[model samples]
Target: MMLIKRIAVALALWFTAGMTPLKAETTLLFNVFVPRSNNFHEVTAQWAEEVKAATNGEVTIQFTAGNMAPPPEQLEAVKSGVFDIAFIANIFLKNKAPLLQATMLPWLVDKSENASIALWRVYKKHIEPKAPFPDAHLLTLFHWEGGQLASITDTKINDIKELKSRKMWALPGPPADLLKTLGMSPVATPAVQVGEMVSRKIVSGYMGIAPEIARDFKAGPYTKTITWFPRSVTSTSFSVFMNQEKWNTLSDKNKEAIMSVSGEHFAAMAGAASNKEMQAALDEMKKNGVEIVPANPDFYKKMQAAAQPQFDAMRKEGERLGVNVDAMLEDFIKESESIK
Candidate 1:
């Protein structure tokens, strides 16, 4: 009788377990090429926390191990589903976001905030319609703006003419183009090569976002002068993308939870985060007695005129990309001025 009772109890327990639903969960992998301390990594970590909370722990974002994936491999990793998500520095994928390059036109706006906002507006209206990324879902777009010229010499970069014939390490695409147009010898080198190239005196300096001084290249000590341009040269754009297959597998609720932290909403957050880094860098530059040059209103106006060729070049490219480049530029200028 006792054996019969045990068998009956086991059967009931097994049946109940089979009837009950298992809790649903999803996990995704994120790959970052830069150091763990990069600003975007911080934002991504924050985003992971918030998204998990929003999803009530149903979704977990796992970052790739090790602090090293080449940036060039990032987008492909996600596309191949080796990683679920990644940050694609758009410059590396030339003509991949062709219309998006309009934001790189030199002397676009004085503030990073205005430039990003204007670009986001233009992107949604014109560029995004191009289906820029067919292989992935673009979660959000951000750019490092207010690019400053950091040189080895202890002199302010007060005149555009001063850069003429000087070797400048430049990212490919619009920056290299702008540097060439500005009459600087633009050397296309990887970010990791910047400091070595500088040490060899192959390039006098580089124009990049300020955090790179302390972070990427440890360039601050090597830099004797830092010049903050007004109506700044183009910002380098980056995209946070998810593998479309993985994105498609997500429920609407899960997708909402993730995307809630991106797009225009996230653009504002990214721009603010970048400004904090720039301010910290500026403070250090002051402490180190680096020559700091702020844009002269008179000089900026003259530089804007000099930037006309860059504008024209990007406009022609935009038209070829199937965007109404002239109208888009007008709208972007209007949006930027409003923000200013």
Candidate 2:
């Protein structure tokens, strides 16, 4: 009996000694509802892999799509550390951080890699440190090129005159403002519902980035004409935000590894994805008998002139908030031009 007891005691001690406690390494979770097939998802996955490799397993990340929570709640969730990290839409959280919307103003920058980089740089320098994002870390920001106007109606909208009195789709907020300026009534419809609405004739037309129309939604069947008006550029600015406490717990080396893969590097990937998607969408539209008509230069100039008042109103609001809106715009233009 004594011999058996001794053996049992020895084995238990040995087992305990050999067992190692699970080390608490940092892990980030991203809410990626957009299809994994999309370019953003691909690049984000690459970024995660790079971080894991760089940390040598010291840090890990997990990405989940389709509303880990609702999309609108993501901003406050990140601030409260509901997830270790979040990929948020800049405009969706504009109520929480209106200053960020300055860059999102329609037609602010030209559609080139330089434009994106410049805008992000300005945000990092002047915008991130503001009160709104104080609870989280700001990572990358980028924009999509302005998408063309697409219509399902028998009458094509080849000119501003044709667009007048057209029931056009608007993605809420500033988009409505843009439609109003164009003398069109805002059709308050989400992108997901676009197919049903168009097919039912609830709306005559809508505008969106080409890639979205081509790859994900198959917009060719619904829309018959693609008016090549480089309407308001609507880029969804994404941020790789970290929960404040979790971020503070990370070692400096790990933080630097994550940040290095962020900002302009991610912006570049985003821009490339957007460019490719746009081309693909255009091709799809053409196959569907969608006549592509470039907007007249005179018309474009006139629209810009009208939209200028809205821009001025925004700038004035920024000034009231003590932000240098004019300087930011000037800096953005300068940086965009400089990007080759």
Count of clashes, each model: 0, 0
Clashing residue pairs in candidate 1 are none
| Top of the candidates by TM-score | 1
lDDT by residue for model 2 over 37-125, one digit each (tens)?
A: 66778877887887888787789888774556666667578777666666776767666677767766666655635656876787866
> Residue 258: error of model 1 in Å?
2.0
- Estimate the lDDT of model 2: 0.69
- The global Cα lDDT (0 to 1) of model 1 is 0.72
User: Which is the leading candidate under lDDT?
Assistant: 1
What TM-score goes with each of the models?
Answer: 0.85, 0.84
Question: What tens digits encode model 1's per-residue C-alpha lDDT throughout 109-212?
Answer: 55556656677778789877864665789888766755656677655566776666466776555556666666666887656667777777887777654544
The number of clashing residue pairs in model 2 is: 0
- Cα distance off (Å), candidate 1, residue 105: 2.4
State the weakest 10-residue window (summed lDDT) of model 2: 208-217
Pairing residues by index, what is the TM-score of model 2?
0.84
